[model samples]
Target: MSTAEPQSAFKVKGQGTIYLVGLGHASTHWVHAMMIFLFPYIKQDFSLTYTEVGFLSMIMHISALACNVGSGPLVDMSGRRIIFLMLSLIGTGAALFLFGIAQSFLFICLLVSMVGAANNLWHAPGIAFLSETFPKNRGYVLAVHATGANLGDAASPFVAGFLLLILTWQETSMAMSIPVFVALSIITFSLLPREKNPHASSNSKGMNLRDYGSGLANILRTPAIRNLTLVIAVRGMAQVGVVLFVPLYLVDVMMFSPEGQGTTMMLMQVGGMVASMIAGTMSDRVGRRPVVFAGVTATTVVIVAITFISNDLLFIAGVSVLGFVLFAVRPVMQGWMMDLTPRELGGSATSVMFGVQALFGASVPILGGIVADTWGLIEVFYMLAAFMLIANVLMFTLRGEDAEARA
Candidate 1:
């Protein structure tokens, strides 16, 4: 009998592939956490209206959305993992450095947009890599990858919040650059192997650009994708509302100090981290539909509860539950999307899901701000709760066998 040689060190399988993807996703989580930490400082420094702040955030999300659409096919065709990874690191690091020194709102917005674009470059390729690497266990692997992001989200805010006490916002921004640079160095030197041309693979079925247009058209025509899109859109609106406004609510409505608000937010991240891991693992064993439906329903309940509570401890409890529900379903949803997509259109399908979510998230803060300005912050929470509940109903309608078969 002939013996085959062992695969290379970078040839990850099972848990290791999940870890690799998780590490890449951690960079995304850190950026999100850092942005939350900087929001208060930016608002104070720029003397900006809530609408203006929303617009700046919108620029970042919109830029990310655009990049995801543009980069999807290239990533699918090239299979240049190391190249995309290195570029993301460099671009994000440079943008962070520029952001630290930005003097005006426009400069800040521009830098943030660049950072968002960089992040977009990182995401699609990384996700596709994980999906392909662990085809049999896509949900489990993808969930673990997402868990890495939750870990970063859980930690970064606490670090950023603590740093803010000792440093200026610019210095805090500068500090955020170090991680991406380190991640890039690791990927360049050790973590990622040289990629084979995607066209060379036996699995390759070249995706024409025109096919992407058709794939999107097909996506729109499918009732499942359509409903899922609406569910995610509503969820995205609620997510933005909470992330952008929670601190403000803690400060103005609940009468908390900055430190207190930061601490509470940190707790939310902790809850989110735990929830992401648990939900991902559980969904692998139980099935995607149950996990997602339960999470969304729980999240809606938590959001509604928050509007009626004023005590700090109670509010933190609600936020913790909110965090759990908000993050727990993420992996299941992403897995569902992958399962729904044809193998040939993996990159394009994932990009469409992300694009829709980004567009929805981008619109929410502005709409929420308008509601807050016209009605009240409490009213914003009510709207967010309603959105979540509606999402829950939509998610419940998904066909389990259909989702599984597609995967």
Candidate 2:
């Protein structure tokens, strides 16, 4: 019914989608960043080794992998993405509330799993909606969405760390769930123009499992998307590795406290915010691969530099640069995928690619945990750099059409 609103010259136009969906993007990163602040507290509370803490994410991501794959086709097929988005918020928020009261290691793990499941459901649908609403400027729009994620990532650790000084980790988690209420209010009250599932109308009364599988298979048959999936997977894996262990490296290797580490994390995300905007615009001008090359190559250099740096100022600068290039690459990659996918299959493509990414990204912590357990936290960077370079190389193989698509 509200689908007709997209062309009515309404003042809000598609911004409703951007703002609400972007908030979800920010929320996704917010959970990860908040966990960094909680890590020390959780470790202390549960007597967890670093490996045990790493396993929390491992379990969460594994659960997310299933949800991510399913969310895409549903978004592609359903007329109720907003409903799905609202549900994602409710479920994740409820899980966070549970996290606040969690007493045992298993209970915390269970809550994180629920949180992960909810988190994975929003992205494909949200991005698919944005792509349909703002077809011409997807690179810029998704970049704006990525910036929301950047701001959230930047804010969460600093806020959580500051809160930890005044409150227990449980209390800080309770506080963290507050944004869910704000987001839910917006989604519930805002007049978001209902976005059509890009897949258009189907004759079937309901989606069968065969439909989901075949739809997903059809999307992946394209070479560009297949290559893109591989690139994003490695990039995602590298990013998770970096974010998961950077705090550990700062605290264990550089002897920085949680507060100091939070500062570094904030700086990195601030830099990412700037880079995401620029890279999205740059992709619309020069091409996705050029932007990809610029961001990833620089990111690789900064990541490797962080390995040896001991100076506080210099290390923070490196972290900042790493964040910039890493976050900048996301929108370009996402926009590139949009360029390659048919409008109808957009949601499915996004989900399948990101699902693979979630798979690889989720696994990084376990592997990095093993490496850190055996060697040192700093050693994790070596693997991260390698994964990033591999991802960078694959970006060269993206569809020429993606490079040509500019506003």
Candidate 3:
């Protein structure tokens, strides 16, 4: 009986929980990517400048940074992962629905701030759950989790484009919120295993306020953790710059229609979906540093080359290649951080990782907006390339063994 019970739990842990979490992850990203898809419409409908549109993202990230800091302690202290996860979906859906009806720029800023703060509720708990469940295959499992995000990222733009053809952006947003609140929330509650005893969980026992503070401080003080966190933040700047400006470039400079922009963005995310699987599995075998080095190096080269390309098809292909290498490294970075920190501190570590990411990443959109207003949209890619180079240098300075050795 004992043997059977362990085996049954293992099976569900291996298959069922991961699927539920991945689906929830996808749904969370659907809200995020959809907002990005609406940028062109928002800019036009409101007669907003580049700086104004960028402020929306800046507000989002700043709110996210604040939530991320608090979420870690909440996850660790409460041991209520599902509650946090559910709130993430519900909050995002509600915000998007309200945003669709919002009439003023100030109201829009408030909605995006809500989106940013709510959206981060998913990551700290989600990452801690997955990392704990799939300890042996951290890289591969996190990659699978990331692939769900790629799906949401890939499909939202295309779906948003199609809906925009038929419905107003307002109507489309209201419609998009339906599945998240109705379907994804149901799945999350139905399939994810309940925490029978939060007090009994290993993560919470004997963990007090002073201990969490001292532990978090110790974790942050480590050279490897600090270096990895900086690398993520710097690389995030490149990513934020690209995601914020690329759609605008597609609309304004390239003169692409909504459908064309969607297709290009879809292709980029599809490449990420494929490369995520490959990079995550490879990092498990070869090591995280090599994968990080190769991926960032390729990302820099592609972003630089993209500036010179004028042909529409070639430009799309270049962006696709950029997505392949750029996102492929993300799961590896997560796995590397998990390897460096203790298992019990997973939530705090994930929070610290994302907090710094949000902190540094918040600056990119506004900075890119200034650069675009001053020079041109294309110049933003040059700035992204510089950020990527700095990320590569930071990654190189870190001294570590392969994740397997550390584990």
Candidate maximizing TM-score: 3
Estimated TM-score per prediction?
A: 0.89, 0.90, 0.94
Query: Stretches of candidate 2 above 4 Å error?
Result: 1-13, 191-215, 399-407
Tens-place lDDT digits, model 1, residues 1-407: 11223232234354554575577678766776677667766887887766676777788789988988877777666544556767877887788767688888778888879877887777667666666655546666777777777776667776776777888878887898788778777766654553543323213445566865786678668777767767877787788788888877776678765567767777887787778777766765566778888888888888888788877798888888788889888877877776676655666666777777888788877877788778888898898888898897777667655544434
- The digit string of per-residue lDDT tens for model 3 on 1-407 reads 01111122234345756767778888888888888889888999999889888899999999999999899988876666777888898888899899779899899999899888988888988888777767666777788888888888888888888888889999999988886787455756664445544323236343678877888888888888888899999999998888778899999999998889988998888999999989987786667888988999999999999999999999999989989988999888998888888777888999999999999999998989898999988888999999999998987668745322345
Candidates sorted on lDDT, descending: 3, 2, 1
Top lDDT prediction, candidate number: 3
| Least well predicted 10-residue stretch by lDDT in candidate 2 | 1-10
Off by over 4 Å in 3: 1-13, 197-206, 402-405
- Quote the positional error of residue 47 for candidate 2 in Å: 2.3
Clashing pairs in 1: none
**Which wins on TM-score, candidate 1 or candidate 2?**
2
After superposition, the stretches of candidate 1 with alpha carbons farther than 4 Å from their true spots are 1-14, 197-220, 254-259, 404-406
Q: Which lDDT values do the candidates have, in the order given?
A: 0.72, 0.76, 0.83
**Native-vs-model 1 lDDT?**
0.72
Error of 1 at 75 (Å): 1.6
Tens digit per residue, CA lDDT, model 2, 1-407: 01121221223355655766788778766775776657666877788777887888788778788898788777766544677777777887788767788888888888878877887787877777777667666777888889988988899888877787788889889899888767777776662334333223322223466775676677678776788789888888988887778877776678776678778899999999999988886776566777887788888888888888878889999899889888999988898888777666677777787788889877787888888889878788999999988977887777466434433
